[model samples]
Target: MAGGGGITPIESGIIEYAIFIVLLPMLAFPIILFLGHIFNGNQTWVKSA
Candidate 1:
């Protein structure tokens, strides 16, 4: 099941999941910021971390 980028279907799926794994933690920052704003809180320190 070869596709574009020379990646097989299995390899593409693995890569997609791996990217999601890596990005999931990085997405926490924005979620924290949004939640903070809703609670009338500030997250200046979270931005630095």
Candidate 2:
């Protein structure tokens, strides 16, 4: 039988959490801006009239 290490799960979970935390904003900003442009009709480069 094979046994699992104790720290591996925690380490992987931490790594995943860190990635999610870091990427959430990185992904969200662009998506929010895109949606704002699409739904709110705001220009990306220019102010709206």
Candidate 3:
């Protein structure tokens, strides 16, 4: 409600949508790490000059 900018949760369903939006990144994060590990396979960081 603090950041809703006067929009009510019942009117916009912002609370539900906010949970989904927040969880999306959280869910994607694990999948991203898994995919990266599979593709990169413990690759080490490169050094720069």
Candidate 4:
């Protein structure tokens, strides 16, 4: 009975960690791209004459 209870929390933790790992890269990519552009300064802005 005690062993069964242990499985429940462990299973829950695995699911949560899997979700965090999957979501982190989705969030990280955009932030990295934005920072790269800001730091690199290669892009041009146009102004009207």
> Model 4 Cα displacement at 43 (Å)?
15
Backbone collisions counted per model:
0, 0, 0, 0
| Regions of model 4 farther than 4 Å from truth | 1-6, 41-49
List, residue by residue over 4-37, the lDDT tens digit for candidate 3. 4677659687666778888899999999999788
Question: Residue by residue across 1-49, what tens digits does model 1's lDDT show?
Answer: 7556776789988977998787988999899988877866456545534
CA lDDT scores, all candidates in order: 0.77, 0.79, 0.75, 0.77
Q: Candidate 2, residues 1-49: lDDT per residue as tens digits?
A: 7776656777878887787888899999999998776867546667867
**CA lDDT of 4 in candidate 3?**
48
- Candidate 4, lDDT over the whole model: 0.77
Q: Ten-residue segment with the worst summed lDDT in candidate 4? A: 40-49
Q: Pull out the clashing pairs in model 3.
A: none
Model 4 over residues 1-49: C-alpha lDDT tens digits?
A: 4455455777888887898887999999999999787867544453435
- Structure candidate 1, residue pairs in collision: none
The TM-score obtained by model 4 is: 0.59
What value does the lDDT take at residue 19 in candidate 3?
82
Top candidate on TM-score is 4
lDDT of 3 at 33: 92
Worst ten in a row by lDDT for model 2:
39-48
